[model samples]
Target: MSDAQFVQIVGAVYEHSPWVAERVVSQRPFASAEALRSAMRRAVQQAGEAQQIKLVRAHPELAGTAAARGEMTAASTSEQGGAGLNQLTPEELARLQSLNARYSEKFGFPFVMAVRGHDRQAIFAAMTQRLNNDRDTELRNSLEQIDRVVSFRLNDLISG
Candidate 1:
């Protein structure tokens, strides 16, 4: 992508999302991917609780079949669709579905993780373990995990 396109993604992220925009817009003219991610983490730390909630809401849930948020492009959608939960083997898929049902029933939202490189078993393990976290604790933990995803994606957006 052209530098203009790269910057546009940043702008797009900022336009619809205020927390990121507030942290990044002033730091514009980023020199490198590292610089952008550094700025992102700092911004997340500086973000208030409400802003953190907004950021958390921007992430896609871990459901294999659901569309990821912030992935507006057809390519992103196609990629995630192919990686849907049903892609797992029958046993693993069933386990994930059960775990997901239990998790959502507890939290009132879908269980979420950045499943970029992880497989079904790993996801199941994470879900099962994280299920033990209390409501407030898990909410914060999940949000931190999402910040990692946002940081990675922001890095790719700026540098690729």
Candidate 2:
């Protein structure tokens, strides 16, 4: 496939960051799904701190304003909803909002987790516990979470 066509298929695997796909276009014809995954991840790793931060910032806060106003991307909406975030009670919503605010305030980016396979309680615990981490640790953790999310997305897009 042409580069544009390839990107159109997988560009969104990394949330709003199509650059991740674009960056690896020159390295096409990956021998296997794992190679494609590795190339995409290496692009992010080599993208430098500013770009990496921007990529992380592109993710919507879980159950944050984007979810409230119905603005999150379809993938995010599905993932969040699958975690029962779309069905939070008022108290739970309020608590989550508070946690999100505090976490964002401290880290300058929304808390991220690969919400699939996790319920609301697990998500909350992770957010709360991660709040104690230093910026470097949290940034690394967020990127790792993004990788997990991307892996799921890639799996859905690619088949054996």
| Model number with the top TM-score | 2
Predicted candidate 2 versus true structure: per-residue lDDT over 1-160, tens digit per residue? 8889888888989988999999999997899878999999999999998898899999999999999899999999999999999999999999999999999999998899999999999999999999999999999999999999999988988852
Clashes of each: 1, 0
TM-score of each: 0.69, 0.97
**TM-score, prediction 2:** 0.97
- After superposing candidate 1, which stretches have Cα over 4 Å from the reference? 1-8, 11-18, 68-86, 89-94
lDDT of each: 0.61, 0.93
lDDT of 2 at 27: 90
Distance from true position, residue 140, model 2, in Å?
0.2
Instruction: Tell me how far candidate 1 lies from the true structure as C-alpha RMSD in angstroms.
Output: 4.4
TM-score of 1: 0.69
